[model samples]
Target chain A: MLEIKNLKASINNKEILKGVDISIQPGELHAIMGPNGSGKSTLANVLSGKDGYEVSGELKYQGKDLINIPIDERAQKGIFLAFQYPTEIPGVNTNNFLKTSLNKIKKARGEKEMDTLSFIKMIKEKSNELGMNENMLSRQLNVGFSGGEKKKNEILQMKILNPNLAILDETDSGLDIDALKTVAKGVNSTRDKNKSFLVITHYQRLLNYIKPDFVHVLADGKIIKSGSMELAEQLEKTGYKGIN
Target chain B: MLDFKPNEKEIEKIGKFSIEEKNFRIENLKNFNSVGFPNKLVEDWKFSDLRHIVSKNFAKLDLKLKPSKEENFDFIKDFEHNYIVLVNGRLTSNSFQHEDNSQIVINPYLNKDFSNKKEKNPLINLNYALSIEGFNLEVKDNYKFNKVLVIYNLFTKDLNENILNSQNRIKIGKNSELHVFDYVINKSEKNFFNNVYEDLYLAESSVFKNISIQKNRSNGFFHKFSKNILSSKSNYSSFIFPLGLKFDKLDLEFNLEGENIECNLQAASFLNKGDHQEIKTRVNHLAPNCKSYQKVKNVIDLDSKGVYQGKIFVKNIAQKTDAYQLSKAILLDESSEFDSKPELEIYADDVKCSHGSTSGSVEKDSIYYLMTRGLSKNESVKLLINGFLSEIIVSIKSKTMKNFIEQKLLSQIYEH
Candidate 1:
């Protein structure tokens, strides 16, 4: 469902990712483990089509060129990125924002838009599944939200949007054990043959709940090793420096 | 260019007046004629530069009142309340169906008080000299209205290159409560200038709330100077949404003359191309234990200029005075400009006073975040702008009023 080869991305002439390659098939969940400054977030941003990045080499999604697509178009094509730190947007209601985003994607796909009643009902159901307070959706988007609440909000958005390729960039960071489990459950429920997942993290804790099909160790802008769940277990015992 | 300076003979043509009133008008006229219109040289008019703006836009400034074209009034269907209709700055009709008629008094304003000191503002001087139309409203003591008072300030289609000056006075008695909505609707097809002077007084323990807004876009050059006085324990709050005019300025002054008085002022506006607007306020804490707050926000687009000058002053005897002022602006284009001046002067050592001003283009990260959610760049910017300005609107306590204002403000942002 997604492919990248020799993807060298730099910002302001400072290279962050140098010749990285990764490929995932439909229904597969891949976990990328790395230490600080290992370009884990950079890879996620480049895949989401964020601006101000000088990227070269091959990057394809669904066998189509993904490099030239704008950020919104990428999202319209079923690509979603759960931010590590969701923006605190004051005066924009969380429910209203979610509805707008969903309707935009729907309109782009030539589908009928959802009305307010159905949108509210769906949001309540999804938020309830994530164990979120219904009151949070009525407040300003991420403004004054707890760290865990913000993370769950991102997951809830992912579930509502229901994208094909979901990239979770450190969605486990700043989350407690309970929130981590809830986020994992949210991801696990949406797993199907046609959907793919890219879980980026520094630790293997999130992988304990949402088992990954493959594990890759990214260090110094390159992936040095690739294996299965055993690889993540080994990295937990020995630090990233202990890798070959 | 045609002469804007009015001759002394024009004063006599307005109406018959006492010798003292005639002299007062002539003195103010002289004050205005000395400086045809305030330019950049004047301290308060520095950012506005009215002389240059007038010279560029108007060839002649007619001081004669024109007959109204008799257009049907469009009352707001969103809510029901009392209304006072002013056609071309002249009080045409009024209704008080929602209140006790005996507790309220309304009349046409005839400025007979000639005991005030000479004014410094040329525009005020011009208004005092030429203004012959407006309203005078008084609420009885210990009475609260059952509904909001809607003041419909309407301009007719017959006004072209004309100037209209009017004065309004509102007095809230002791222990009384009043709420007002100053709604302006203009249908003039040609350019005209409007100058207004408003005098308001809040007696002891009175509560007064006001909201001012424009109904639509118009070819009007508008200016209003409001002077407000608050007595002991009186509370006053004002919300202004002044938009869709070629040039508009609101010069407001509030004086807290008694202890434990509360004063609040907030304004939000969206200025599009060729629109120039200014909100200048001076809040004076003359008595002990008074608190005042002011916040102004603006979203300015291309070729539009927005200015805010707010000042707070505390007297030496006014201990425990709390004053705060903040101004925020987002310029949508490089050519759009915003100027803010916040000043605080405190003579009381125990008082807490602070002021802040910030102006910048919209944050790129915010736009990118919204765009990532499947919104186009234009939609994202509009959403951010609406969100930024709506912070003030969210503070309104009435849900019905808040929803109505939200719809109006949303359309203003989307249309731009």
Candidate 2:
């Protein structure tokens, strides 16, 4: 469903991603594992069409050239990025934000928007499954959410949007064991033959719950090796230097 | 002390009219002629230079007060209120269908002279001097008013430059409750000046809530003043939303005369495309155990400008008084500006008083996050602005009124 070739991106003319290549088929799960400063987060941001990036390479999503599209258009086309650091917007109700987001995407897709009652019911069901408090939907989004609550909320957004491909950029960091399991469950529930997930992380802990179909080791902004889920087991034993 | 002159020709002919029969009117005219207008030399009128807008030769054009039009009163028709309509500064109708054993006394005119009543402010003096008709709106003692009373001040387009002057005194008697909505509509096609004065007195154990909306189109200028006095065990709440006017200088004052009185003063103005609005407020705690709270917010874009000056005073007898004041603004453009001054004057050693003011542009992080949720840039910015002002708008007690104001705010945002 997605493909990247020789992707080189930089910020402020300082190179971050030298050359990277990855390919994912529909219904497949791919995880990028690396050490800190390996450009894992940079790749996720570049793929999501964030600003202030000098990017060059061939990136295709559903056979469309994705490099020139705007950030919101990319999101409307079902490319969701679970932010590592979510924004705290005071005076903005969480329920209203979610409803507006869903309607925006639905309008872009030429689909009928859900009414208020149905939208509330669906969000309650999804939030309940993610172990999120119903009251959180009334408070300002992420204004006072705990660390785990913020991550869980990101996953909650993922479930509510039902995107075709969701890039979880370090979705497992700073999460306790219980939160990690809940997040993994939320990610696993949305897996389907037409849906894909690119999980980027520094450690293999998240792979333990949501096993990936393929594991790629990214070193110095380039994917040096690709293997099966057992590859994560090997990386846990040996460090990045020992991977080669 | 400035060399400003009275520009309105009709104002100079006030002696020819019979309304000068009252001594107060003549004193007020003298005050207006001598004092002229407010300028930068005055401390309270520092930011708003009335002389700049009301030029020397701008006469109050002569126009006839015609009958009411349907469109002039459309915006406030849906609200649940006792309707009081004024056409060209003249009262046309006062009706109340819902009365729960309440006494509402309306005196069409005030006999006393109030020219020397307010000596410090010249614009207020001008209002009283030119005002031909006045209203004494009061609720008798121990009588609770169930319906919200709405006074609609509307204008009709005329060839002559219009100057509207009207005074109203509202009194909520002991142990009574009342809610008021003062809505001003400028349906005139050309620019005019509207100067209004309102005096409110809340008796002991009475509750009063007021919401004022000034929805004037482009090139309209208004100078408004409202004075309030709160008695023992009384509660007073006021919310002012000034959005659509080209230029506005509004002054509000509250005096806590007795113990156990509570007052809330709030003002919000959203300006765009060179629109200007200024709100000045003062709250005095004269008795012990009284409380006052004030918050003013402004949002401006393009070349608009907004100003807020708020002060809190505590007398020596007002020991154990609690007062808080805050002013905040959001400037959305480099050319847009906001000026705020929050002051506190306390003579009581045991009183608690604090004031704060802040201004800033929209947070980039906020915009990016909203855009990531599939909202366009314009949509994202609109949502942020609305959310920023929702804190003050949500405080309105009536759901319909809140919705009405919200719609007005949104339309103003998008229409530009």
Candidate 3:
């Protein structure tokens, strides 16, 4: 589903992601485990088409150029990135934002947009499954939300969007046991043969909930090793430095 | 050294009007003679350069004129409200009337009497000099208005440059509730000058919501000054929306006369195509336990300029006064400009007062976040701006008026 070859990226004339290569097939759940400053987050950001980055290399997704398209175009092309720190928009309603986003994608896919009633019903159903309260949908986007609530809100969006490829950037950090389970359950419900996921995390705790098909250890801006789900357990016992 | 002189054309224009009671009119006109329509030299007129804009043209008193043709505003058709139409500063037809049993009275204000009031502004003095007709509204105690009262101040096609002046006074009795809307729609090509003054008095425990909308299509110059007085336990909420114009200025003053009063003043201005707008505001915390909040937002495009100057004063006796003021602007391009000056003068040490002002372009981070949600750059900026200004609109106490102004606001943005 995705291919990256010698993905070199830099910010402010300082290189962050050195020559790196990775490949993910359809229906495969991949996990990238790394320590601090190991370019895990940088890779997610570069793939999502964020601004202020000098990137060069061949990055393709679904047989199309990923880096050349705009951020919104990439989103319309079924790419979703769940941020580690979601922004708080003080005046934009959560439901309205989600609706606008869904309509954008639906329009691009030549699918009919959901009416207000159907949209509300669908959002309510998904939000209930994600354990999000009714009042949270009317509130401002991430404004004054608790740490766990913000992550759960991200999960709610992911469940509603149901994109072709989802990138979870530290989605499990700062979540309690209950919230962690809720996020994991939400992700597990959406797993299918046509969808792919690239989960980035610093700990092996999140892999325990939703098992990965391939686990890659990222060290110093490059993937050092790739193995099965046992590689995650290996890293939990022996840290990233211990493996090198 | 304040040197004031009146121009010859202004004097000639004043002579054209036949005055029965020349004493008050001449005195007030003489007061305007000394000030000569406030210029940049005046402290209050520093941001609004009214003298330079209207000095070359004279406000004519042409009585030999035909009634203006009817104007059809598209948004007005979608809503149902009582309408009082005025064209070229003349009352055309009013389908709405004050309730006789409800103690609400509406009449033409023809009072030439001058009072020893507190506000001493040159424009008010000019309005006082030319004010022969306007609406005087009064509501008695415990009366609640069931319908929204809309005053459609329309400026239809005009062939001459006229000076249209209006004076309005609203007095709400104790425990009364009223909602009023005043909208100005200009469709003429002539560059006429409009001067309007509003005096609002809310008795103890009364609630009043006032809204003003101004959309000047042609190159017109408009100015409005609203002075309000609030008593104990009374609440006064005022909202103003100015979409686009050639030249516009609005000044609002709130006097907290009694304890436990609340004043909310909000406004939003969207200007482009070299339009200029100035908003000057003042809130005086005279009594203790008073609360005041002021939120002003502006979005400037092209070479348009916007200016906001607000001040909050807490006296020594006014302890425990809570006053907050915020003014923010979003400049779309390099040519557009915004100037904000917020001031705080407090004599009480135990009062809670804060003021802040910010002017910047749209944040790239916010745009990127919205973009990642599948909204394009243009859509992202528009949505963020709508969110920014909608906060003030949602604060309105009247649902119908809020929805009305909100629809006008959205349509204005989308039409571009």
Candidate 4:
């Protein structure tokens, strides 16, 4: 569902992703583990078409050119990226924003819009599943949400939109044991045979909940190694130095 | 009216005219000379230079033009209560309609004995001397008016006209409620100057909401001064929206005279090229346990300039007072300038007073975020600007006013 061919990206004249290549098919989950300066987040940003980057090389999603699509269009095409630091939009309610985003995606897909009552009901149900209270939906989007709450909120958005490809960037960094499980459960529930995920993290804690079908070690802005789920356990036991 | 000659004869003649018209003119001139215009020399007005607009000769407008009722007056024609019409600072008796229960007091300056009190400022003295007509409204105690009170100030151009001045006074009785909608509409293309002074007195337990809409011509200059006095347990709120004018200045002052009084002032303005707008407000807490809140927002495009100066003062005896003031402005272009100064003067140590002022361009990250969501850059900027000003726009109690403001903001963004 997603492909990156020799993806070269730089921010502020500093090359972050140097000729990185990766691929994932439908119904499969891939984990990219790397050290601090290994350009994991940069890869996610380039895939999502975020601004402020000089990128080169071809990126294709579902047999279409993905490098030129706007971020919102990418989102409409079922490409979702859970940001490491979600923005706080004051005075904008979470439910309203979610409805707007969901309707945009639906409209792009030539689907009918949900009525107000049904929309509220859907939000209530999804929020309940994610252990989010009703008041959180009415509050301003992420104005004062805790670290774990923001991550869960991102996952809730993903579930609502039902994106084709979900990119989780450092979603488990700030989560406690309970929050980690809740977020993992939310992500796991949204998994389908047509949906794929690119889980980017430095640790294997999140992998325990949503097990990856493939594991890859990213170093020096390139995928130096790739293997099955056992590679994750081996890295967890010996760290990145053992493979490098 | 004095001639343009800088001779003692002209000054003496105008001085005599001022004394006969307003008894407090001489005392006001003394104070005006003492304080002058607070410029770089004065710390309080350091950020704002009033010297350019002040310290100059303003012609005394003559009440000669007759009232012309031509346009559709649907906004205020159906009111059952009494109303007054001011045309070029001249009050017209034939144009006004009065009801049985409503009494229209015209030209209060002719009946009430005028005095020169030490507390009276120079601007008040100038207005008192030059005001053509004053409307005194006294709502009966415990009286409830089913209709709204509407006052219209219509300006027209005449041959060789320079300026116009008007003043109005309103008083609401105890347990009475009043809604005053003041409209300033300009119909001429002349370079006109309008100076309006409004004084509102709210009795104990009285409630009053005043909404002022300025829809003047593009070439006209408007200066409005409003002073409100709130009695014990009275509630006073005002919303000022200035949309069409080349230069506009609004000076609003709220005096909390009695305990437990509440006052709220919200203002918004949108300016385009060569348009200058200024909103200056002062809230004085004289009694204990008073509350005041002020919010002002402005959007400037191209070479336009917007200014906001808000001051909150808590007296020594005004303990336990809660006061909050905020002023923010967004400049769309690099040439546009926004100046904001929020000041808090507290003599009471136990009072809770806070003031904040901010000026900047729209957040670039926010724009990128919205653009990524499929909205164009312009759409994203408009949405963020709307959110920035929504804090004050949503507080407007009138739905019509709220929608009008929303439309105006959208149009401004489109034009930019």
Ranking, TM-score, top scorer first = 1, 3, 2, 4
> What would the per-residue lDDT of candidate 3 be over residues A155-215, giving only the tens digit for each residue?
8888877788999999999999989988999999999999999999888889999889999
Each candidate structure's TM-score, on Cα atoms with residue i matched to residue i, is 0.99, 0.91, 0.92, 0.81
Model 1 chain B lDDT-worst window of ten: B62-71
In terms of DockQ, the best-performing candidate is 1
**What's the i-RMS for candidate 4 in angstroms?**
2.1
What TM-score does chain A of each model score against the native chain A? 0.99, 0.98, 0.98, 0.98
- Tens-digit lDDT track for model 2 on B158-223? 624666677778898999898888787777777777777888999999999988886655556778
DockQ for the candidates, in order: 0.80, 0.71, 0.72, 0.34
In candidate 4, residue B237 scores what lDDT?
87
lDDT of 1 by residue, A1-244 (tens): 9998999999999999999999999999999999999999999999999999999989999999999999999998999999988888878888899999999999988889999999999999999999999999999989999999999999999998889999999999999999999999999999999999999988889999999999999988999899999999999999887898
Regions more than 4 Å wrong, model 2: A36-38, A217-226, A234-244, B1-23, B56-72, B75-79, B100-102, B114-118, B215-218
- Candidate 2 collision pairs: B24-B113
Tens-place lDDT digits, model 4, residues B252-324: 8889999999898888777776687888888999999999998888877878888888889999999999999
Error of 4 at A185 (Å): 4.3
Where model 4 places Cα greater than 4 Å from the true spot, the runs are A64-69, A76-78, A102-131, A176-182, B1-19, B22-64, B73-113, B116-130, B143-162, B179-191, B213-220, B396-416
- How well is each residue in A5-28 modelled by candidate 4, as lDDT tens digits? 898999999998889878899999
By lDDT, who's the top model here? 1
**Each candidate's iRMS in angstroms?**
0.8, 0.9, 0.8, 2.1
Q: What does the lDDT read for residue B287 in candidate 1?
A: 91
Docking class of 2: medium
